[model samples]
Target: MSKYIDKQTELKQAMIALRQERSQIYDELKEQVYHTSEYLRPSSILMRTLKDFNKEPEYKTTVITSVTSIIGGYLSKKFLFGKSSSAIKKILGIGIQVFTAKLIAGKMTHH
Candidate 1:
């Protein structure tokens, strides 16, 4: 009976750890999906608009042109706003890379 109880306890602990790891992986995947969708959303919209225009050119030129202009404006803002958001993103990416490298170095030194 005592051996059975110990085995049960060990099984419970193993299940708990598995659950925790699964939860962490789920959260990370959700975050990645959200960020990826955000990055792709504008392009998706542009593609849909183009597809619609191709299907119905006669009915869509003016509307498509307007939407295209809007998309162009948005892309322009993304890359060429006065401060240039693209530049900022590049700088931020470099900063993150540097920070990550430093963190890895610190961890290695600690070991």
Candidate 2:
């Protein structure tokens, strides 16, 4: 009877060890699924980009400056330019305005 009791105790200890191992394996599989799952992977790129955009202060400003320069150049060429004006002159004008705007913005941001 004492031998049977000892055997029962060993079985119970083994079962507890098995249960703990199972729990750890379950957690590892859950983490693997989260990493390789299709639904999470595609959206993760956008999420990461948005996260980076939110985290980085300079990225948004740089994009805004580029877009603003392109729009400004187009507007200036379309409205401020005369039909008879040379293409080279128009381009130079746009370049000058964009450069000046960037310089002013840089100065403002620095101060």
Per-residue alpha-carbon lDDT of model 1 for 9-92, expressed as tens digits? 999999999999999999999999998897689888789777887898665655644455555444444453335347676666
RMSD of 2: 7.7
Mark the regions of model 2 whose C-alpha exceeds 4 Å error after superposition: 1-44, 82-111
Worst 10 residues of 1 by lDDT: 76-85
Q: Estimate each model's TM-score.
A: 0.38, 0.39
Best model number under lDDT = 2
lDDT of 2 by residue, 1-111 (tens): 999999999999999999999999999999889777854686887888889998998998877766665665566555555453687877877776676567655654565
- Alpha carbon lDDT of residue 36, candidate 1? 87
Clashing pairs in 2: none
Off by over 4 Å in 1: 43-111
- Model 1's number of clashes is 0
In model 2, how large is the Cα lDDT of residue 111?
A: 53
